[model samples]
Target: MTDISVFPNSLQKLVKAFEEPLPNLEAPPGMPRIKLNEVIGKVAYFYEKLRNSIEFQEEHLLRRNAIERILRRKILLENRNLVDARLLINELIRARYLPNDALPDAIVGVVQNYIDRYIALLDHLKLRRTSPDDRRLIRWLISVASADIEERLSPSVREDALVEVMYATIRNNLVLPESIPTGQEQDILVYLAIHRALIKSDDAILRYHLFRWAYPQWQTPDHAVTEQIKSHFQQLVEAIERRINHPLSERLLVICRQYTIPFLVLADVFKERPGEIRELLTSPEALNDASEKAMTKRIKSAGSRLRRTTVRSIIYIFITKMLLALAIELPYEVYVLRLSNFLPLYINAAFHPVLMAFIGMSAIVPGKKNTQLVVQAVQEIVNPSAPRMVFGKKLKPRPRSRFRVWLFNLAYLLTFVVTFGAIIRLLQYLEFNFVSILIFLFFLSVISFFGMRVRQVVKELTILTRRENLLLLLLTFVSLPILRVGQWFSKKIPKINLFIFILDFVIEAPFKIFVEVVEEWFSFLKEKREEIS
Candidate 1:
């Protein structure tokens, strides 16, 4: 074993986390277990898979989304009592969002208690029940509660511990301004950066983090604390809203992404021998061995993840395209255009998925130089003698002359016209009708945006910053306007997603009730057989 005396204090917390036994979750005796019928469970699982395919979300966020959906159905639509939390938990299990028989039955009580506390807090705030702010508050509360439930069901203690260690290490190494106008603490910014880069947290996850920060005792708040929070609830909301989109967040995210590979390498090295982490850090041969192994494993995993994500994206695009064809294209062609031609329809449906597959197949993985950079970065992070990394430089607004601004705007407008104009011209050449051309452009932009996003998997494994070649710059110039449009549509479509609304509101409620009834019938038949036996 290497001497612990030589190791820095920054790593002590991480060492302790790995050395300690993982916390176990046990079920309480005599609490009624919630079970679903096997046949119904299988059906529910299949239905959930189909529903989930409609909305592209990170795989990790699916469970939280499931929780939110179930809660909204039970509480908001069905008006179920918070005490009847077993029904909600049972549905989650039946859908296979949570595992079978793993969660404690008493978790129902925990969920119910959380709902009660949130309701109490809302009442204390005295906001008009039907007001927009109140509704927003309720939605936010539900999202936070759903996230909490997901965590309780499947805790990420090791991940959380790593985040804390990374935060501490980054903070210690980072040089920051003495004071900031943004009013965000440097430590909180560091925490947010780690969550975004390392944990890959989306806005919902970050919002939940902000909620925890705003009300630290939310899990177990007393009357006094509740009252105090009530007085500052509006202010707290505004603060969180501001911080969520703080100007400094993007720069911090870049910095955090820079360190992600190194932190991951360190985690992998320390995973097996928690007690010997200090020794592993000290030994150059061991560190190199571990780094090589980790880099190889990560590259392989990234390839697999890339393929999986690409397949999913293709499937999503194809399904959505077909749905849109049925909803909009077919109707417009038959009624408005009075056309029998379905060639454009066929091409529109197939194009985006084909393009996505092409993008996926063409993507490349990082090389030996990237791995070397990662190893060196990891060494730097662990070595106390390395110089501090400067961070938190204030972003100053650049002043541009009116002529320059106008000229840039004109160039951007021309680029947008040229990009769409070329595509429209091509579609026209192919005998694509006006409606078909519009649909093609719509999916083209959205799919291009998605394709670019999928390409980020390759970037994640790359440690060395890639230099932009002339070809790359040209391609980016052409694609940038389309990507911007895609980004806008991506944000807007979720709010008005017909598929989500239909599944959640139109079909899901009745479908779930039918499943529950079938389960009950199965239970009744089993009881009768037992009695006969």
Candidate 2:
């Protein structure tokens, strides 16, 4: 009660006005609109109260709760319910509430400090679950303490929160959630303000929004976000141009590299802001349409490009394998006499078409292929939406009996080593020469390594279970020598193209047809879905 009396009369009156039922949007009969001087004076007095509450109070949580309320009232007046402020603070200087140029800066200072303290308290409670009852009480205190911070601040802060959540989702390779906002116009002002703040300051949190926006894959950056990225790149280039000396240029180059924004990469970013940015900021529908089109184009092109690369890679592999076989066989014929008893075994092991055919066929299966179900499973693992019960009676930990673990480990090792040893022994039993056995193993290595790469790409698309992980680990041991051989082979034959002639008639035609069929199927499904909707 004593504390209430200390507030300036204007601040006290403003608080009372908020507590009263909201007056009509138009001022009540003769209840004249709030004077600009009164509003400014109240704001000044309110800031002092907020500062004192946060700085001098021993009850940190209570202090934050108080400031939260006061900040909400200021935000409401500043934004004027997301419309223009009718009460002009421009007259505050004449009224002597504040100096001529200091009003706006002072407002920003007070509001920013309040925001900082509120965020600090939030940070302290990170990763800890607050009970629903506690959350409701806190929210009520905040709402009743000030005005509606929940409604006013929520829209502004929500876009940033959505972006952060989306970043986490995509960075972890999860599917985008339907709950995320899809290009709302209300987010535009908040995004621009956040970006402007980022440019003027070195806050890591602010800088991260820019960083995340730069990647177009996960979420398409809006016009405002794109403009800011371009601005950042432009500033970087101008800084490089200002530095005349070689040392300065080198430093600039290092800085550019660290930021992952090279001059060459940014060359076209400054050509022009897209028409999307040129329009009124209020026009979000057009922006969203353009973004959706770009995303569709990107996804479509990726599939086609992937098909083309796969075809080319297959052709390359076929020719390389034939050349490698000839390279090994021709030299042996010249150096050794024909009387060797191992000649038949060597020929079967080194030049058998069946073995080569099997390796080529592996491409058709391409293990670890992605499906919708697999993607959703990975998404759930990364970001489950349901609340988990944490306060139930403590459960016993899963038995980690070492004997069972050791037995499994022992069996895994024996199976791996025995399978590998059996292959070598079979080659020897078949009377394959040491050279022939080595060549056979080299081809096997190539197949294993290729399979490993395919699995790795699939792993990026879906999380693997323990069994799959163990299988991949076993393959890695076999693939290491093959990967080395591939490196050596690449250096030896830097370029080759004979497979183009042979495979075009066999593999290439079928692969192209398959890709076309897939594309057609996707188009048909999309058309049907749109029609049904």
Candidate 3:
């Protein structure tokens, strides 16, 4: 009964402790709970709390928005240039439709006056507030030219005003959450269409002509500006309502913001069909599906390319290893061993080199859905899940006895040291000369280095299961020593290793150049095909 009662209390404490980020403290035998580890745990708990604090969230939002704003500006400039170029092309098409209905010179002057007047009023406000009278005037101007104009052109026109107001609000040293939704696609498009129509309706003027006709002829004075400027200063009163607020571009914006192939390809598609882009952005699932397909296609193409390279690499490694083995063995046998019978020496020299060649070959061989798995791992930042837990609490393994723990550490250290020493001893025992030792070390380095790399790749793709940890522990004995030797060899040479030297200068450069050239040609053809289609 006492044990059962104690269990519930311990379990409750475990659950409550997990609410903090610190791992639950399980008392070790003959040890107090308030040790160095516990102190660190408490520090970590406070750190986690601080990270999730409101101030931190607001800071993160502001930083992310700042990055986004810079990107937006860049993309907008790029897209604006693209729009301008396309606008020239579009004028030709529009000319065919409205040849006689060109914008008159008088109307052009009037349009410029209205634009200048509005800009002056807007500039005077510094984008803060447009009076009801100014709002009415803007609406009246927008409605003037279109025969089919509704009471509201679209929600975008109002949203544009809000966006500019928010932009001004930020400029005025205000940080507010309302600014986050400033760059709605519709609003941006509406602004772009009107702004460009006004600029580029030189050859074809229907859109601008309608806009000009919409303006009221009454010449209202610039009296509102001075009155508003005075009133704006007068209305500045300190009202301590105790409110809290949070805070927060274009073609260059889109290009800088989106890094994925899916996003880029979809953007290109949208360039041709703006309506579809708007529609897809509105429907989350449809947009996601399109993005997923583009990513899948890209991954598949990369996988296929990797496979072809791997095949060629395997063939090269085999030939290179065989020739290199013959070259290394012939000299060692002739000079050091002084053996008339070269067959045994040849066989012995070939063993390590062959093993190394195969390892190199294996590294390049494509695993099933290897590219997709790698992409998935990257997308998840290689940590797909939380560490395994029991209910709400972490399942801390039973502590190893001190004696056993000491023995394990001792064994691990000894194995690491002894394995390296044994490799050196074995090469000496084989009566290998200086060159043979270098060859053996180089091959050994390859095995160790590539094996460790493979293990790391596997480990990343795998979760930390019991079986995985056990397999990893077993592999460490083989991989860790080799990794050390590889590191040492890499440090000693720094610039040149026989294996990488041959691979890089002889094989890698030429093959890479050829592949890139071929790829470029293929890309060119693909583009042409797309254009034709």
Candidate 4:
């Protein structure tokens, strides 16, 4: 067996985490159970799938989003009591967001206690209820607390340990510029990078993590602790906002992305031999074999993941197009334009989805050489003697020259004109009217950007550094404007998404009540039968 004494400090910490016993969180006896009717549960599951596709969130984020959505629906829309955590928990289980009976009924009380703490803190702060900023802060704090509660209930101990290992490895390897300055700021940069690159956390999750880091006592804050947080609240918010979009984020993200696959490879290797992780990490030959095996498995899975992501994107684009066409184009044609042509509307609905499917299918998966590269990277990560993978970049400011700025802005404008103008001309040639053209262009840009994002799945599997060629440069020049617009739309559109609004506010409330009544009716029937027997 290889010597454990020779392992790196980071690797040793990982081994210790792996070996540590999971904390006991056994449920107390006599707690009630929340059960859902199978037929109703199946319907709810299908509805969730359909609703989620339109939202376009990362897979890892779906659970937390569901929890937040349920909480919002309960507290905001239905005006339900904050302490009715059992009811909320029941709904989550019925919808299959949480597994059936996996969470103890006592968790209901625990969740309520957590909410009460926040409410108490809010009361103490005495922020004006009428103030929009205060209201927003209250909502945000509760949301973050709910998310923390969900994590505590369903702790990912192994995954957390793995992330910690990745963080440590990254912190050691990264070489920041003098401009970044060595302090908590630099540490936060690395932490944020790992969170983004490895786990694919969205803004809400990042906010939660940042809040936790700032106020570790938030979970069980005393009166004094609450007062401290209240005093620092504004500073905390400003600090988080600044760090979320820190100048060096993109730079560090690139480095973290480079290492993500190799770290994932290590995680996979350890997973297969949980009992022998120490031995495997210590043995170079064993670790190499395991890493190679994991890399091969990942490469195979990458193709299937790409297909799934593409199909989801296709469905999302198609559904969104249909909704927009029905909501906007069809009405415009009938009322505003005083025309009845249906062909352009049908084509608009079909084009973007088909294009996305093509883009997804065309993506190339990593091959043997990439796998070898990943295995080598994994070995380097765990091996103490291996040279640290140093990454450094100097932060630079935007051009201050008026002429240079104007010239750059003009070039960007031309790209927009060239890229979009050509598309508009083609649509006009195809007999698409002004309204139809606008809708089509909107979807095209958003779908193109989304398709590019889906292609990142392939990129994640790749260990080899990507080199840009002339063709790529040319393509980027033409597509840059469209992608930029799409990126902007993707962010903004979600805020005012009509479909989500309809589902959340208009449809979901009554539908959930109906499901609950049906469940109650079934329960009543069972009770009658049991009494007669």
Candidate 5:
């Protein structure tokens, strides 16, 4: 305060100006002395206009474009695109374009048309590959559209929705390379940018407007173009899954997979009620908003599935525990035979019919055979891979299906042993005569396993006949039926057999619990591996 007299007159005026500083600015450090009051006022006015235009105001395409232009220029400048004073000229141009005084209301539509045409032009690039300048224009258009879209960014969406939006963004971005500015391709890219940023925002309503423009036609779809885009989409999903660094990344990968992974059994989804496929994929809340009755029915119908998911999940868990328990409970040979017996059955029943139906599906519906195929096809998926590529590859990993795997193991071992050994044991039990019951039991076991997998199970398991796998399977076949025969004797005998029956019960309970535990544990691991691969 005492130093005012020592300073030059111009410095004195600046000091005075600070006391009555420009309405929107204080003199910044290192700024040269200049009449920047008007400049500050204009800049503040422009920013106020920008904030109001895209998000706060009705989302007129023109106002959106204007705000985007401002953001683009600022972003460019912040990125150090200019090395000279021309940035000043660009700023002046911006100021002129978005002046403070309200423009006439009718002029808004004209500006909107310009904005619309600009956006449309950017969207037309994917099919019309062009030169560098054209690509630059496309990038510029996208940059602007992104600016418009992000004006509404907020934390209003559910974590799941956020995950989906991020996944959607990542999939699209995976295709875009850094040196992507090409002329004829500009429109296509700009279109992509608009939608990418649009969905990223948390606006409750604006998101739908953004999506309707980009989807089906603009954004690459898995369904329509199966070859190029499908593989690419799969790759994108895999890459995202691998590269996920955040918790939400998992959900993102899932959403990406959901879109890329075609429902191998969509007919099952449609079986409930005549409902739009979109309703299932989209929010049920949105569906409810459309019709309360529809919502109630939809929820009521899904209630069974929801309950089943919980119950099945619990059962799967139980089955898994039993499998683990068996590793310790049974002898090595018994384990082998039991596992082998079940695996073939598992593999056979797992994906047999559906795989067959998929292989031989004909548009012309065949005769009565169609029903058989449909029944089988329906069972297969409730019963296996990539609808698209994942990060340049399309390998689908089988999760540890403890239940299915154990079933296959059982099938591999039990079929022949139950059939052949039961007969030998029955001959001893029936006064040296092999009876029909033993033959029937043996035959029944064999037929059951055989019926489940005539083709796939046999094909895959034969290819996977590891020595350890075989050894454990062989043991189970010998042990399980002996246990069964012992139990039969215990049950048939008089009071003295009570101790033998108890012994048999002990053997069976441990075996059952062990199988169930292992089944669930393995399934959990398999699911984890599947997600990664």
Candidate 6:
């Protein structure tokens, strides 16, 4: 009875606590009632708050047309070169599109006059109060613009045509969420679509984009600017509320003020600094102090230890690959006969030089000190003239690994011999003539390909001479086995088929995953090149 009573109260509190970020929390034990309900409630609350916020913002924008007179005057009177009228109209349209809480980076292009005028109003209450008469003027100007010309066409037709043109332009330019941007130019266009959702106070769209980009974890930081931008944003939100209250809708004003502030600040910064806007909006890093970095390194090392013991490593891969080969089960000689028919022809292809280069690289880089030597020596910023590795300092040679490679080759060959020998004895025991020859041959070929590919991957991982080239070759290695052997063995084999099935699946899965990783890596590399150029 006590346990049952305690559970409900505990759950209610849990639901409340879970309102905060779940990933940030620590779990001890036991499920809470609130946690059970939290998943649905958070999502519901997110939409509800966003919806209410939008409706309230729309009401506020209508109320705040008091500045339209000054805006129009500023636009009409300013020289097009010094203060483009297009900029003012665009800024207003953008503010309406971006979220009241978040601003698009495009605001970085607003003219100093508009910025100064708004900032002046912020600092002076008397100036804003005196602005009431201008509303009358603004109303008269709108009336004139809408009035039908005595000698010309009707006002309705002119307005209709303008509306149609704008509609066509919007449709032509708009980007939906699913579209993959082709270049940085598209980032601007996509940002405009994002801003429209923001203008309506849609956190849902914002969160979706965040998830699509893989959020903070996936983004690589350029200047660790996101945190700075985020912090400034929080401060901007607080400041707007303190300043803009009592007249219009507070929620709406708060949203618009916050939404416009970031882009305005960014635009102002870029007006003088020029390319700095990219550094703030796209960069993903949250800057850390030295202590934080040290702690992170320690955590990664600990996690690596867990993965090695609990998650498996090189030894596991070697055993698993061998098991997969063995599951195909064929005679030693027959498998060899089939493979020898194919292996030499393929190995002799131009790919052999590439493979030998990797093998030779593995031999060159052995010790930890020598590994650092090659990396640092490659770049003089890291190593001075006469070349040093590891922080521009002197480098030591890694002891040769040829001996290690020779021993590995010897052990591997002997293992093949012993496995065939065991198969021979098993065949004799069963009086199954030629069974050992057939089975050993099949497994030997399969294992040999798997082994060579695994070793090549290890070589690439351990020796980093040209990572991109290494990546390209890994594709060939991954595809070769699948094309060569995927059709047979697993599909053909019966009885105890699970091992072969699993093995084949694992082999193919890694390559597909690698291709995806390489694609993202190339994208990141391309973006970096843009920054450099």
lDDT of each: 0.77, 0.36, 0.37, 0.77, 0.35, 0.32
Candidate 6 structure quality by residue, lDDT tens digits, 217-281 = 31233233334433343343333332222122222222222222112222223233333323322
TM-score of each: 0.87, 0.29, 0.31, 0.88, 0.16, 0.19
Q: Candidate 2 at 86: error in angstroms?
A: 59
Clashing pairs in 1: none
Candidate 4 wrongly placed segments (more than 4 Å): 1-5, 20-33, 78-81, 127-130, 172-179, 319-347, 387-410
Cα displacement (angstroms), candidate 2, residue 176, comes to: 25
Maximum-TM-score candidate: 4
Candidate 5 TM-score, C-alpha based: 0.16
Winner on lDDT between 1 and 5 is 1
lDDT of 1 by residue, 1-533 (tens): 45566656656666666777666544556645555677789999999998987677777888888888777676556654342567777787888876666667667887677667766776687655357777677666667677777777777676777787677566655544555443347667778878889878776677777888777887789999899888887787777767767777777788678668777777777786677676677787788788888888888988998999899788878888999899999899899988898888899999989999998878999899888878776776677665433222332324468799899999999999998888889898888998788889888888888887888777777766679999999998889999989988888887789888889999999998898889889999999999999
Query: For each candidate, C-alpha RMSD in Å?
Result: 3.6, 28.2, 27.2, 3.4, 32.5, 29.7
Better-scoring candidate (TM-score), 3 or 4: 4
* Residue 408 C-alpha lDDT in model 2: 72
What's the count of clashing pairs in each model shown? 0, 0, 12, 0, 68, 24
**Model 6 residue 430 lDDT score:** 46
> Which ten residues in a row are the worst by lDDT in model 1?
388-397
Candidate 3 ranges beyond 4 A from true positions: 1-284, 287-328, 340-413, 422-435, 447-467, 488-533
Instruction: Compute the lDDT for candidate 6.
Output: 0.32
Instruction: Between candidates 4 and 6, name the one with more favorable TM-score.
Output: 4
Residue lDDT tens for model 2, 1-533: 12334433432342233333432223345543332233434444454343332221222133233334233333332222221121112222222332443233334343333344333333333312245554533333233222222212112232333233222322222112233333432132233322222122112223333333444431333445444434454353233223222222232222212211111111111112222222411233443343333333433444454445445445545565567646765456446734346453445443434433444334321122223223232223222351212111222213436798799778767665766577789877876666767777655655444433433222222222234677788765554445655545433432243442333234433443344355457658778999999
Task: Tell me the tens digit of each residue's lDDT in model 5 across 1-533.
Answer: 23445433432342343233223222345543222224444544465453332221223243344445343443232332222222222232334433323222333343344345334433433322245554454444444344333233212222223223323323333433334354424333333332223232222123323332333352323334334333353343333223223233333333333222111122223333224433432433432233333323433443443344334333433453345335432333244434332332332232333332322221121223322332332222211121222222222223446799799878856665665666557544543212223433433343233222222211211111134678777766654554454444433442344443343344323432343355457658778999999
Model 3: weakest 10-residue lDDT segment is 239-248
